[model samples]
Target: MSSSSTFPRARKPKLGYDTDQVEEFLRVARRAFDGTPAPGDPEVSAEKIRLTAFGMQKGGYSTAHVDAALERLEDAFAARERQIAARLHGDEAWLREARTTAQVVSNRLARADGERFERVNPLVLGYSVKEVDRFAERLSRYFSDGWPIGIDDVRTVTFRAQRGGYRESQVDLVLDAVVDVMLAVR
Candidate 1:
């Protein structure tokens, strides 16, 4: 069993990631990171870490701490992935792939606001086009003008949901690609 202090508990009456789930996931992550994954274990990757979510429960692990730890774990995995790719494919090939991914992301981000992503019907709830466009502008600046943007900024960004807005899945897929580009070059 993992120690209770592995992560601080959420304040009473507040909910956080379920402690058992978080601990079990961490144990699996540890095994994956150490290159000793057991049979039947789901493959773990940087992308998997980035996408991981846990159910909430009262007195569970603090969400903030768990999120930060996951971010670091993702970074470590990404770094290892980069190193292995460079070793196997040569540094230039690794860089070329990163550049290609960046170009694709940049081209998508370069589209005009409200046109960058597919829109949901007025009756359907989706991300606000204006808000998503605002963030897309920032991403464009990051790629075109070398504007400063942290990975966390991309990771934590949220847009207001509204009727007749950009499709949430499309926006999420683009954001995931952006994170991939960021990770590739880091």
Candidate 2:
């Protein structure tokens, strides 16, 4: 009855209906039929009558087979979604690790160069953080409950930059002076 074509049976086999069930229904139907002969009346027991009608309504499809098919489809889609999500999480984890490694490398570089840190971190390689040693000092300030490093005095640069265009040598002196003062206080 479905668009799905079935192979033509050389001899129509009685596989669709359960023979035992049909026999039981026939035994019950005979008793019911004896009382009345109504037109187009199905004489089977109520349950058997419902079952037979259900069978015809489904065009001979077994409910068990249909349910199994749906379950298998659900399982496959769930597995596929999980696999994709796992791959995405793996990528995200790798990115976070890369960012942490980059920050660590930058801190080492900043310490190697004797650059003094200001309230605002003084090193920015365009968009990328080429140095991040000041982040450590900031963390220390936060964790130490503002004890040694006064929160207000973070911008304590005693000497001002020279007015008439700074030379490389003068800039280095400024940096050294700031570092010396901070280290002396510590």
Q: TM-score for every candidate vs. truth?
A: 0.95, 0.20
lDDT of 2 by residue, 1-186 (tens): 222322121223323333333344344444554545455655443223322422322233344443333233333433443445448776456445444544443343344323423222233222111222343344334333433644223322233332222233433333333332232222
Model 1: per-residue Cα lDDT over 1-186, one tens digit each: 455888999888899889988988898999998999988888889999998999999888999999999999999999998899999999899889888988988898899878999888999999999999999999999988989999999999999989999999989988988888889887
Each candidate: RMSD: 1.2, 33.2
Q: Please provide the root mean square deviation of candidate 1 (C-alpha atoms, Å).
A: 1.2
Against the reference, the lDDT scores of all candidates come to 0.91, 0.35
Best by lDDT: 1
Our model 2 lands, by Cα RMSD against the true structure, at 33.2
Error of 2 at 67 (Å): 0.8
Shift in Å, residue 45, candidate 2 = 42
lDDT at residue 127 of model 2 (Cα atoms): 15
For model 1, the run of ten residues with the poorest summed lDDT: 1-10
Query: Which parts of model 2 are misplaced by more than 4 Å?
Result: 5-56, 91-186
